[model samples]
Target: MTRHHPRPRPLAALLALGLVVAATALVWARAGAGPDRCVERAERAEQRSELVTGTGPEVLVIGDSYSVGAGVQPDQSWPVRLPGRVRVDGFSGSGFSAGASGCGDLSYATRAPRSLRTTTRLVVVEGGLNDTDQPVADLEGGARRLLRLLDGRRVLVVGPPATPDRTWGEVARVDATLQRLAGEYGASYLSMLDADLTYQDDDLHPDPAGHREFGDIVAAQVEAMLTSS
Candidate 1:
């Protein structure tokens, strides 16, 4: 007499398979699945209007983790904290030339078109820190490409802040490049090279207090630029 064990049940196998798939999906999502998953769209609608249209005042802001408020809430981001309605589109680990290592090709230039709107009077592009390791030419070219797409529109290029972990020289180079491009494109440039900003545990992103301080500084700068223009 032969003793044979019952084959594994199809239903049990299917359940186990489903769990595995679900776990994998969760991991993938956390690992920068796509722009929708990584790029945060935040808006502060109740503030005073700056750039107005039929739909009301709106400003488009695009950048990386710093712009996305990496360590804080959506409302805490500098863009959102700025006066008026701000449509902030931020992808972590991205920049003008640098693509997010985990989030596919989500550079400032690549995401610019999607966020640009006719009604918006101002387009604020805040980034460059991620491109610190990239070549100077690459950074310039990337910024130029994005500025070209924003031709004829109001643009404010806010260079990345100096982080404790990053080399100050590289950060300054990126800032200088962005400043030059902003001048060429007739856009306003806000250099953060001298900004004494605090960061989170990672030493890369700003903390809540840092975001607030950054927002205040940027808000003042933006207001002055708009008033002059």
Candidate 2:
């Protein structure tokens, strides 16, 4: 008597397995491709040290890469360009809920404690673009949490500008969310959604010229708020 051969696996089953493997591999690659968390944390810690040791800046600007000067020089960044002593606590690839590999969880709220200082006359919260993909509830929750932390302080919530990489709808939603939160928290809101801005090759971050323009716009807003107050 001959032994029965093992039954062949179905082609559809094999194809499904391959797709799953491919998708999993992609996720892993993306996860590993993010900036080193340790380095990011160290840099953030350095920023805190500077703020703590040196003369506290008049304006404390907290944001993502735009505040960090992603593709430009330190002085070229808009935060430094703002008309007064400004200290930036910008983390690239970070947002209210967008925490990269090594950055702290729920980035903005987690670091607000160390970033704000007694000398900071104005707290300019400048971001939301990174959280474009976040659910409205999550985005609102994150903004509320950060705003609560800044309660009783002078705050200017600067929402994200429109970018080529992001849909107008997506950017507008973020802008709207931040604006609502700012109003509820007694903070002034500045929306950059309509600004005609330029960006780097990536179409995400602003170029040198764009930084200058952004700085000018923010400076004007800051001045107006401070003057009125």
Candidate 3:
């Protein structure tokens, strides 16, 4: 009878298995370390938190078509449906750049109150969609100017909603610039593009259901911020 010996496991195979295990453990550790980064990323990616609130403290929503009703009813808009006592100053067609032609500017400059006086504590800005046609630097400068106009009021900077067009890369650039501005100014930066409200009848404006969903997102963020503040 010949002696038989069990074969040793292949070193390369063992190494590969080890690497996989190590990678999996590393991922698990990272995920367990803090607030679900994945969930946060998903939420931020959706860009649904454009409308900021200050219900208990006082709140204001100011922007263009995205802020306004667009295809949705005025009451269904985030600024309108947000919980608690809130005020809306949204204009349907405004842009950040001065004299920028569109519904945002006309509504913002002509209709919306220049200075909120009703014990206003928080302000949400939702413009810049129209500004995509302009240069990024111009858009940034316009945003800065808008922030300056707000004075001492606590503000939240909301970037424009995303469109289905692949060529409209300017939206990302504008959103990034606004987010940087928000950080510089110590304000909240919410991305309408990340909110996942991209599906619209015209591929530009959100429908009524979209508005309601967006409003809920904004309301949650506002409520949390106000409660903490």
lDDT of each: 0.74, 0.77, 0.64
Writing each residue's lDDT as its tens digit, candidate 2 over 1-229 gives 9999999889999999999778756643543333355475457536533542123337888887888777787677787657557777877766777433223464688778987877778888888887887678877877888999999888998999999999999999889888888998899999998788889999999999999889888989987776666
Task: Report the C-alpha lDDT of model 3 over 1-229, residue by residue, as the tens digit.
Answer: 9999989989999999999778766744533321354343224323323444444666767676666566554555667666556666554435676534421234233433554765877777777776776767767777776676675777777777677742458788778888998888778888877677645667777777777777777777777677776
lDDT (C-alpha) at residue 79 in model 1: 73
Q: Poorest 10 consecutive residues of model 2 by lDDT?
A: 48-57
lDDT by residue (tens digit), candidate 1, 69-132: 7667666667766765677777666778743334556678887887687787778889887788
* Clash counts for the predictions, in order: 0, 1, 14
Which structure is stronger by TM-score: 1 or 2? 2
Model 3 misplacement above 4 A: 1-55, 103-113, 165-168
Per-model TM values vs. the true structure: 0.74, 0.78, 0.67
Candidates ranked, most accurate by TM-score first: 2, 1, 3
Best candidate according to lDDT: 2
Clashing residue pairs in candidate 1 are none
